[model samples]
Target: MRLVSVDIDGIERPGAVVTGPDGVDRVLELRQFTGAGSLALLLADDVALDLTRTAIGRADHASLPRLADVRLAPPVRPQVILCLGYNYRGHVEGHHEGHVDGETGQDALPYPNVFVKTPNTIGGPHDRVVMPIAATDVDYEGEIAVVIGRTAQAVDESDAMSYVAGYTLFNDVSDRGWQDRSSQWALGKSVDGFGPLGPWIVTTDELPDLGGLQMEVEREGVVTVRASTDSMVYGVAFLVHYLSQIITLQPGDIISTGTPARSVQAQSAHLPLADGETVTIRVTGLGELTTTFVR
Candidate 1:
């Protein structure tokens, strides 16, 4: 099921299950039904509610308000936003220019190039992305993010999928100049409002074939990036297994499986977003996330 976090009137709230052909979002008040913070909480249930059954059985949807009337927030309150770099072959070749062959004329790193984005960097779907004047080379990297459901350490690839609660869209906004200035990507990637996530989180059962999903990013209505999850050098299960070996992944932790081929950096010019510019990213079953740039 598609779950969302929303702010009704002035109070912040969570829980929305996708319903209908009109694209109308149905509200599932977590406090009343589940007493939880995120979709991860719901997934922890031994007998998870089926999306169709839940939607049909909800008495609140008829008595309460529609989701479009409320302000939205990021679907999950992620503790850490882990990101992967060069996970897709085309993205590495395109963004690195001719350097896709590697700096030493060798090959790219055999394993996933991992980095972290602070939780503060995350914003909701309709939120404005604050563009820092300190950097003029900001660009967008659209990716599919996995939300962890269970606490895990040294998880195996075979069991990795069990730890996932759901998936969401992520925009790994970066300051190209700051990123290249240091070997660490923290300064460039962890900027405030740099990570825009969610319209909602789709439960893992809702999307059994995530590997076949398409991801696309558009700037001002023009598509700049387009590729499928099939292009990923290391898939989600492998990432979860690899990450758990080094760090404990808790419920609410987010792992954004890297972007596809096509970011402004790939074009070789600083495509810094101007104030009022909008970027929209969509993943095949996960829905869309839109953020406007503001100074």
Candidate 2:
């Protein structure tokens, strides 16, 4: 099921979208059955997912809305956003030391490069991201994000995926100037509206084999970045297990798994995002998320 948080009559509500018997796309008002007001609450426990699936089985046609009529919000309200930098092998491309080897050598760190983004940085899928005045070279990093299902600490990779609620698309917009000023990435990555998330969240049961999914990003209708999740140096299971050892992963906390190769800086001929431009990213099965850049 494709779950979404939508704005109806100025009120944000949780919904489950499905194709009705009439062959039309529709969203089932999940709040009624789950007894939860928002998607965040619906994802808080396993019971809610079971209740949602039961409702969908015998849902009333009138309760469903045309998918296009609904305005979407970020599917979940996360307490903190964690992103992995350079988790993909080919994304660095000489921009950083030891990146060329692509994690083959013994010198690589045991843990991944993890960074944090403030909750305020998150925006809806269709929202416009204002380019920061402090930096001129703004770029995009399209990645697969993991939504934690349960509180986790010191978990192993074998038990890591069991704690995941679902998956969503994330656009990790960054300002190269601020990002490169120091080794730290928060200042450049955590700007207000820098994180564009969601079309909806596809539960783990909905989309298996996430590691084999294809990812692509387009700028003004031109495909600039393209690769598959199989290229990630740190897979989802390992990332979850690694981070859990240091921090307690909570429900509704978001972790972006990192973008694939060919960001603007990684490509020799690629151009940076300019004012009034748009970037759209799609990961197979998760759906498309589009964000516009403005001065």
Candidate 3:
């Protein structure tokens, strides 16, 4: 089942996408349930999303709003946005000029390189991201974002997957100039609206296996980044378990798995995103996110 946050009379409400009786995809009003399925109840009551899934299967379609009519909000307003750096094997293993040598890259890292971006960085999946005045080279990092379902601390690697709620797409936009100017990347990475996350959340139950999943990013109609989760140095389970040991993860928290290096298509013409241009990230089975850049 796909879960979405929707704009209802200027309020953010939980919704489920289901096919209408007439075969049109529509958004089911989850809040009307006053039960487990509501975003409020689901999170605070720890209600099983199974209830929502079941409802979607048998929802009354006549009253539901067509997907095209309801404005979407970012799937979840995460309390904290955790990010991984250089987590992809392609990035660590001989990706670009002066990149790490393949022989010593993957195993050389002792732990996942983690970073934090504030919740303010979140934006609607189709929102316009304004180019920072100080930025000269605006770049995008397409990532698979993991949304945590339960509170966890020091969970075993074997059991970490259980904490996941669902998956969404994220574009980690950055100012290459600001990023390279200092050893610290916070300024470059945490600009408001830098992270465009979600059209909706595809529940983990629908996609439990990630070993061979593909994620790609397109810019100017060219597939700039194409990668598989199999290329990650630290798998999702490992990263979750490792981070849980350090900090407690709560429901609605997100972990953005790092991106792979640019594909050969992008390397040949490495131009930064310009005003009015758009970037799209697609993850098979998850969803797609498109962000337009603006001045």
Candidate 4:
């Protein structure tokens, strides 16, 4: 079931998207539809409920309110946002001038390249990504964010997937200049409202083959990034296990699995976003997340 957080009559509420009795798409307020109080509870369940049988019950899609009318928020308010860098071979190679050589060319990174963006940076679909005055080159990196369902510490690689609640889309907004100036990536990545995620969260059980999904980013209706999850240098399960060894992975914690090639940086040599431009990022199963840049 796809769970969404929506604003109804000025109050933010949890909702589930289900087809009603008339085979129409409708958003059911969780309180009215199911005993589940929040999306987090639905995610924590091990058994997937047949949405049609329980909440949806075949209603007319036209009967539901238009999704655009509601104010969107991140599907879940995460305690922390763990992000991975250079997790895609193409992204690593592209940043180094299209050369993938390990010995003498651009692909010579010594580590896995990890970083963290604070939870305050998180926003939701239709949120605005503020282009800081300090940044001259703000770029968008579209990535698949993994949401952890249970607390995990020192988890084995084989058991990593068990801790995952589901997946969502993330726009890893970056200030390229700040990133290059500082030895640490936190300054460049942690800008408030830089990370925009979620229209909804899709449970892991609903999507069994995570590796086959595709991700893409579009700027002002033009596609800039396009690639599949198959290109990830390190998979989700491995990263969870890797991070669990060092830090505790708690429920509502988010780990962005990294972006694919063809992002803003890869397409343009040195172009940064201009004020009033829109960036849209989409993942196969997950929904689209759009952010408008403003000075």
lDDT of each: 0.75, 0.80, 0.79, 0.75
Order the candidates by lDDT, highest first: 2, 3, 1, 4
Query: Model 4 — which ten-residue stretch has the worst lDDT?
Result: 97-106
Instruction: Tell me how many residue pairs clash in candidate 3.
Output: 0
- Residue 115 of model 2: what lDDT? 82
Model 2 residue 62 distance off true place after TM-score fit, in angstroms: 5.7
Model 2, range 45-159, lDDT digits (tens) per residue? 6888888888888878666778888788888778878898777767563453212435343226466777888898888886799986776678888888898878879999998
| Lowest lDDT block of 10, candidate 3 | 93-102
Best by lDDT: 2
Q: Candidate 1 residues 183-210, lDDT tens each?
A: 6668888888899888888877778647
Kindly report which residue pairs in candidate 2 clash with one another: none
- Mark the regions of model 3 whose C-alpha exceeds 4 Å error after superposition: 21-23, 33-48, 93-107
Q: Which stretches of candidate 4 lie over 4 Å from their true place?
A: 9-11, 20-24, 32-38, 45-53, 57-63, 93-111, 263-266
Candidate number with greatest TM-score: 3
Q: Over 4 Å off in model 1, which ranges?
A: 9-11, 21-23, 36-39, 47-56, 60-62, 93-108, 263-270
lDDT of 1 at 11: 52
